[model samples]
Every structure is written in C-alpha cells, then in structure tokens.
Target chain A: MPKGKDTALMSWKEVPFGCYILESGNSVKFKTGDWRSFRPVLDKEKCIKCGQCYIMCPDMSYNQDEEGYYIVDLTYCKGCGICASVCPKGAITMVVEEV
Target chain B: MLKELAKFKGFSAKNLPKEEPFAPGHRACQGCGEVLALRLALKALGMNVIAVSATGCMEIISSPFPYTSWRVPWIHIAFENAAAVASGVEAALKVLKRKGRFPKNRRVDVVVFAGDGGTGDIGLQALSGALERGHDFVYICLDNEAYMNTGVQRSGCTPYGAMTTTSPPGKKSFGQMTWKKNVPAIAAAHGIPYVATATPAFFLDLMNKVKKAALVNGPAYVHVYAPCPTGWGSKGEDSIRLAKLAVETRIFPLYEVIEGKYYITRKITKPKPVEEYLKLQRRFRHLTEEHIREIQQRVDAEYERLLRLAECL
Candidate 1:
C-alpha cells in the first residue's frame, strides 16, 4: 500500500513463483479512500434499506447493518456519487472531504 | 460444478446474492461500470469457475503484482488469445476429469472476459475458432465502445459519430464514420447455443443471462454494453443512466439468441429518441441535427431487424 516504496529494492527471491498470488482477494489490504474528492453521507431517517446503494456501488463500499440500513465504508468508497444518484429516497448525499 | 438456475428466475432486490467474488481496493476508475458489470457477472456465476482475462482494463485493475481482486482462479492471457486460453483450460479440465485425476462430478465453468478491442478486433479470429470448435466456455465481451485501456481509440465495436483519440470529429471527417460492427450477430452466425446482449443497468437480467450461459452446454457469448465514464467523458454517476437510455432509445437492443432462435429480453414499447442517449456522453456531442437523425434512423432500423428475428421464433 506504500506508494513511495521502490520496486527495485525488493529481492528476486521475494517474488511469488510464476507471480501467482496465493492469497485470494488480497487487494483488500490496500485502502483507496484517499482517491475520492467527495464522500457520501447517509441520512438514516430517509433510508428505506432497499439495498440499491449496496448493490450499485462500484467500489463495494456499502455494508448492511443488522437494522437493514446500509452504511458506506469510506475506506474503499471512491465518492463517485453513484449511491446518492441511484437512491430513490435521496438518503445518501455526497459532500466534500467529510472523511 | 456449475449450478444451473433450473428455473428462469431473476434475483429480486431484497434477496440478491451477498457473495463478492471480485474484491474491492483495486484501482478501477471511480464509478467504472465495466468493473461493476464484471462484479455482477462473477456474482451470478459464483466462485466455482475459472476466469480468463485478456489484456484490458479488467486485467490491469484486478491484478497488480502480489495482489489480485479475483477470489476465484483467474488467468491473464494475451490481447488476442483469451478464447484460445479458455479453450485449452476447458480441454484440460475435461481430460483431467476423464483420467480420474480430478473429481469426475466436478464441472468447473470456464469463462473469458475480453474488452471490445480484444473481442471484436484482435481476438475475433481466436474467438471464432473456439466457438466453431464447440468449446464449453462462456466468452463475455465487455464493450466500453473504444480501446479505453490503451487510451481512447477507435475499435470495431465503437459506434458511428463517436469521438475517440483515433476517430476525432473535425472539419475533415466525423468521428467513427463506420457503424458499430454487429459482433453478436456474428456470434449467432457461428450457430452456438447461447448469445446475449446485456447492460449493468439491468442487473437482474444481466445476472440471469450469465447464469443461463453457464447452464448451456456449448460455446456462449454475452456482449455487455459497459459504460466507461472516464473514457466516454461523462459523469461517473450517469453511467447507469446512460446504459438504461441506450436500451430505452433502441440504440442497443437487449436480446438473446439460443440455438439460432432469437428472443428480445427487455422490450421497449415507448422508446425515447436516440438524442436522449447521445447527449449524455461528450463523445457524441459534436453531432449536428442531421447526424442525430442519421443515427436515430440507423438505430431504429437495427432494432426493427432484431424484432423481426425475435418474431420468427
């Protein structure tokens, strides 16, 4: 996840044989929240919990709570405003740098 | 083994599948509909499959060094040989099962994900050969309308009057003078078992078609109209809306061809004008009124032709 690390510093022995990543879905270790210029804020009162935002988020940032309300994890949300635009009830709104 | 949806049922809003085969944290562009389509696709097919990716946006974003977004087994092949690699994978699986080296009952689905440039242009020959040879694999073409991975350039699947780096609209010429090639028709011509056109806007329909493709025995090709907000010069939030308009305006008709029989998936009874679809993307912003009319007529005619084919069934 370190952006400044030099690739040349790594030894050839550290590379995976044939470059096959043994850990599946290992990309989750890298957080991409900093890339977003905007962040989505949910209005809990207006949410119908239709799961629309949860399914539609390209970043897979939304997770449903036990109460059936959807919460966006800023760790991966790209602030694309898709969730706000797709929300039928206008529960989610995009704001600048809320995170 | 591939679990076929015995009944032709679609997932409702409340009961959608919760599993995510494509993980987050990879660097796909914000609001990238292509990756969203890929996510929905792998979700529909489940994790019991092997995915072969061509050198495209999906390949680059999903796998970077020691990290991979794919939870299932994936292979990255060349720009023009995803189908070939998939064919080899399917053949190897068959041979291994027959030799008792693997579980005889295990039937892992082989699926290929290729971009527009890879599918309709570079990989067309390889795809044709694999389909003709009757390989048990599903080839999904994620068409973003141009060579988006290598920067926006004209592709065989790029629509007429659309601006790209290579097909720039100027005083001398209009963007993409030629009409979009009918790749799905070409696939249908191969006389394969399954062929479909879907968009991520209709998530249920897209997922159901993918499931059905895996259910079918022979070669299956699903052409997905994925919106590239970054390349198309459109608002990221408009990706889904644009795809929906593409269907409603009759610009990209949704349908399926099963063993030479055609069936229109989402019929648009009250269609909107083609301009409604074109005006959203800056790629088609340079079109004059006459050009708009030309595109409208062509889209309507193409839809009518498809309707006639569906009617024959």
Candidate 2:
C-alpha cells in the first residue's frame, strides 16, 4: 500500500489511536486545483504586487517570489477568482482551465 | 494577575500581517467566506494561540481524519461544547501557569471557532455559562446562517425569507418563519468585556476586532458574517461581493460593544436597498415584494435601535 494513505479502511490495529493526525499541515499533500473550471492568469507587467491576492485568497495558494510578485501555486488554488476581483490594478484574468 | 496587553496601533490594507496561520488544501468550496474569516481571525491572534473548533464546515473541511490545515495548536471538540471546552482549557492554563508548569512570561490566547448552529443553537447554554463565569477566552461564531456542513439546513441564526433545506419556500411556507437571532446582542447582554460583529469583506475591521477580543481580560464574543456560496445558490466568485453587499445594505452592520457601550465600526451613510442584497443570492430569490418590504422594515428598525445604543456613547 502507498505510504500515508487513508487508514479508515485499514484494520483496527493498523490505525492510530483516537484518529490522531501526527503531522501538522499535512493537507498540503492533497491538490484541490482540479475542482475549478477556470484558472487565474496573472499579468506581470500590470501587477503592482499589493498582496491583495495573497491576503484575500480562501486557499493559501499564493506565495511571493523573489521579485515580491504574488504568484499562485496551482497545486492548491481552488480558482475562486477572489484575487482577480479584489485586485485594484485588475492584473489577474481568469481563463478556462485546459483539461 | 491581570497583565497589560500590548497596544496594536491598527492594520491598514497596505500593512496587514503576512502570516497565514490557517493552511489550505483539504476542502472548502470556492470563495468560502467562512474559511476566509477563520484565516483572518488566526492571523489576528498570531501563533501564540490554541483554537478549538466545533463540528461544522471549518472543522470538516480543514481536518479530514488523516490531514490537518492548522499550523497552530488546535483541538476538535463536539458540536455544542466548544465554549465549555475552551473555558476548561483557559482554567487549566491558568492553573498550569500558577503552578509554574507553563511559562509565566508567555501569554497564549485561547480561541473558540464555532458555526451559527454551534453558537446560537446547541451551544448557547455553555457559551452563556462561560460568559457569565468570566472565562478569559475569545469565542468567534462564524455565522453562515444555516447548518451548512450538513447541507444547509436552517438554524436559529438563519434570516427570515431565506430558503434552506428544511425551510424551503413553497406554496405552504415562506422560508424561515423566524428572524436571525441577535447572538452578538445576547453576548453583550452578559456584560462581557468585549463583543463585536465583523465580516470577511472588511479584513482590517475583522482583524482589529479579533485582536481586541484577545486583549480583553474577560470573555469576548465576535460574530462574523460567513457567506456560503454553494449553500446559498450563489456564484463562487460572488461570495466576497455578497459579503460586502450584505453590510452596505444594513442587513449585517459592523459594530462592537465594550462593557455595554455600543460603537459603530463601519458606518454607512447612504445604505443600499435590501432587495439589491437579496437578489444576489438565490436563497432569497423566492421573496416577493411584500417579503422584501418586510425585510427592509426589520433592517431599518434594527439599525435604528443599534444607532440609539451607540448614540449614548
């Protein structure tokens, strides 16, 4: 079996006592980007990098690069378009996610 | 011994904290305001805190048995006793500090995050008891207005004329028969040190109120307006927009009560029509003109009543 797979279906002895999650912030392993029909594309030239996208995002998918540009980590972005809408510079555009 | 809290000047849009205490990944719908409020609350409290959440959308979405999104110390408790558990935690921490078991110099905030059902319905008794007994904790009720985790059933905090699974509007019934319970007012009535109302749309206001809640020496209650897009039949991107509209329309006013004195936080001079706010969410789509008028009247009366309270201060 794959390591760290869901142990709910496993035998009682194999499961951890009291359904305890030993590791913290382990939800990063699960990608939720597939759920969105649209994806936000950032315009580097137009982006002033106010960090609105980073602060307002429901999913903590946006990270600041070396240039301080708020970039989305697509693995965890749910594509809510909150950043696109809240951006004062209107630097983010949501395009149809290509399957 | 009561320690003096460090004064926070305030947070402007430009200078908000960069720390993201609530991690992302397990599952919350696109543009969930509940998670947004939760994240802002944790940011305000910072890392020196222990959060206790009830069985609701946040607890279910963030922790899925094997995974967790919390970076700080967290405990998941039953649906009704979040406040009860939080009080016990506060008492234990006090004892531990007194006995020299825990560090006396370090002050850790104990916070409770619960939904409307957990705070206004099932958990009201325990919350009241904690408030009356003066527990040094902050209880944030993420009011999505329904039992959203269990597929949007109506709760006591659900507003009138809004449709939910159990309170669907039909030929026989007109959505929820009762008005949204004023839980913040109820908390303030306990004569607690701090009580406030906030929404995710106003990030600065929310963070300030939450931080103040932690600063107070006694129990503090912050009722946050948590918008549920999937449950309310609204577009995913419209969640934040809807939250803003709800406040502008006077449906959810932002204010804080400190020791029985009311202070309006974001005062709206020219309020929008309640119908404008209602039209965005399909849950209120079924309301007729009469229903809209009724809702508007109620909103005006409530706002006026709050204005009267704040006027004295």
Candidate 3:
C-alpha cells in the first residue's frame, strides 16, 4: 500500500481513543476538485501559437514548460471555454475529464 | 451616556434575520446582481408570498429538480410567461380568498421576477397581457442589461455600443448599435396602477416601491437596474455602487409612475455626467468620443422628457 494509505488505515485505531493522528495521511479532499476540469489539447498541426489562449485564460491554467511548448494545468481549470475561443490559431480544444 | 440616550430615543437598531430565502450552494456566477435582487425582494416581501421566476439565472440557479435555494413557495415557469404565471396564481388565490379556502382566509401576493431578456424581449407580450388583464400582482424585471445566463449575449435592453457575444466590438463595428428598450415607459403605457424604476443601491427606495407596488390593487411593474459583474467585466461587489452611479448619471432615473402621474423620487441635486457610469463597465469600452456625446445627448433628452412628464402631472 502507498505510505499515505497505510497511514490512513493505521490512524483508524487511534481515532476512537482520540490520542493519535497521522500527519502524512491523505484525509483532506479539496472541495474545488468536484468542479469540472477542462484540459486544453493542443493541435500542433495548426501550430501558429499566437498566445491569445494563454492571455485570455483567467485561471492561469496554461504555461510554457522549459521546452518552450505550452502545457495546460487541468487541476484548476473551470472549463469556461474562454481559452479555446480566444485562440486565434484554433490550436486548442477543451476536453472534459471523466470523474 | 449619549449612546444610551440615543437608544432610548428610538435609535435602537433592529437585527435583520440572517436566514436567506435564496440560500447558498446554488450555481450563479460570482457577483450576480439578479440573485441579489431576488434576495432583497424576498426580504422586502417577507415569508408570506409566492414568487414566480422566469427562465433566467435566478430560476436556473434556485430551482434544480428536487433541490431549491428558495425557502418560500417558488415556481419557475417558461421564459416569457412569468407575468402570465403570476397572473394565474393571483387569480387562483383571489378565487380561493372569495371561497375562504385559504388558511385563515390569508391573501397571497404573487410576485413575478424576470431578466431583461425575459421582460424587454421574449416576455413583453405575456407581460402586456397580464397588465391589460388587470391582475393583482407585482412584476419585477431584474435588468442586468444582457442575456448573461446564455453566455453574455446582447438583448434588447443592452445599451448602444455595448459589447456582448452577439454584439462583439470589432474593427468595423461599434458593438451594439441600438439603444436600450424603454421597458418602464411601455409598462407605463399600459396605465397600470403603479410602475417604477428602482436600484438595489437605494435599499430604502427599493423596499418602499416594492411595498407600495405590493399594496396596489392592480398590476404593478418595477424595473430594477441590476449590474452584472462577470458579464460587464467589473468587480462583483461594485454592483451596488454601479447601480447608484446609474441613478446619479440619470441613465436609470429613480422614479415612479402612479396612476398616470409621474413622480421623480430621489432626484439628484446635480446630476453626474453619463460618462461616470459608462466608464466603469468594460461593456462600454468600445464607445468612442462620438458615441459618448451621442449617449450624453440621449440621456439629457430622456431626463428632459421625464422632467416634462413630472411637470405635466
């Protein structure tokens, strides 16, 4: 088992006694994760990256990695479709992730 | 103490209940003015009334299947039929009141809430029908200036040269070309018992108008200028301040049309320039110098017209 999962399981015995707690346990679930995630899939074929998508996205979900290529962070993406629509090159498509 | 003396002399503050009729957990965009309007309207009306909301942001957010943000008995009808629905409810309540079928012969005032698109555009016919038919109900148009729920599309209430999804400000175009439809004027033409324009920024004025409209025997129309933060690219909390500026600028005059007479309530001693109101929202960002002059001219013309009406009465 993973270290976090093992910690969670071991903490159950201490929960009833109210004496022990695991600091490394994955007990906290972020409330915002339930909201829909929109990942921008770049179509390199239509590759005139004008950076409009990067500028328009309110969440700052997209950034160029060290390789100088745009990468999207899906964790905080609200799927507002603003980035895709603002892309002048139409190089980005918003994809919904399965729950 | 002076504080104790002040309290003794009818200066004690009453605590308003924190229980919101429009509860949290419903999905409305951050800083939605329509929700604020509904909440305030409900607060004024209290718990004894039933609300009929049109198919807009308020309805979509408040009523979803078995879940509801509304603590009061609320109904969401078709987009254009909120007034008509409220009329029916009022009629039914009237009949029940006559028959003494209601609990303790209580009277339920029917209140209809709708957006600008629902009122000035799609729902105008139904609203006219209700008004002409002389229903005992209050109809409120929470005018946020556009079809915000449908992704900030331009509606008839959208001002001239204001950008939206439908009226994008492009190199060749100056956003929306048409002026906002004068909905209160049209409602006034119906010669209803009461018709008024209000804003949430003036809470007491809004509450008093609502109370007067509620007590009126026949149909009453209240058009509230609700600011949309997300749609207008403005700060959410600036809604009330913008509403106040709208009134101060004379873009939305706080006035009442009562029984064929016009009364200008809360008139500004020195009206501010329309630019003060227009400059705050990004919707009017495309407005040129010529456009601003035209808007100022129109605002002055409308203010003069209203003043003439007040003088006539």
Model 3 chain B: lowest-lDDT 10 consecutive positions? B4-13
Model 1 agreement with the true structure over B1-313: per-residue lDDT tens digits: 1234356566677668889999999899988999999999998999899999999999999988778899999989899999999999999999999899999887789999999999999999999999999999999999999999999999999999999999998999889999999999999999998999999988888998998998889899999999999899999988888988999999889999988989898999999999898899999999999999999899889998999988976
Per-residue alpha-carbon lDDT of model 3 for B207-295, expressed as tens digits? 66776777777899999988888899876545666887898988899999988889999777698988888888888887888999999
Q: Docking category for candidate 2?
A: medium
Give TM-scores for every candidate, taking all chains together and pairing residue i with residue i.
Answer: 0.95, 0.95, 0.72
Alpha carbon lDDT of residue B80, candidate 2?
Answer: 89
Q: List pairs with backbone clashes in candidate 1.
A: none
User: DockQ for each candidate?
Assistant: 0.80, 0.75, 0.02
Off by over 4 Å in 3: A1-99, B1-19
Candidate 2 residue-wise lDDT, B1-313, digit = tens: 1233355577787777777788878699998989999999998889999999999999999998678999999999999899999999999999999999999989899999999999999999999999999999999999999999998999999999889999989999999999999999999999998999999999889999999899889999999998899899888788888899999999999999987888899899899999988998999998999999999999999999999999986
Predicted candidate 3 versus true structure: per-residue lDDT over A36-87, tens digit per residue: 5555688877856555444334333456677555666665455556556556
For model 3, what is the alpha-carbon lDDT of residue A3? 86
Chain A TM-score compared with the true chain A, each model in order:
0.84, 0.84, 0.58
Q: Which scores higher on lDDT, 1 or 3?
A: 1
- Tell me the spans in candidate 2 whose CA falls farther than 4 Å from its real position: A1-14, B1-6
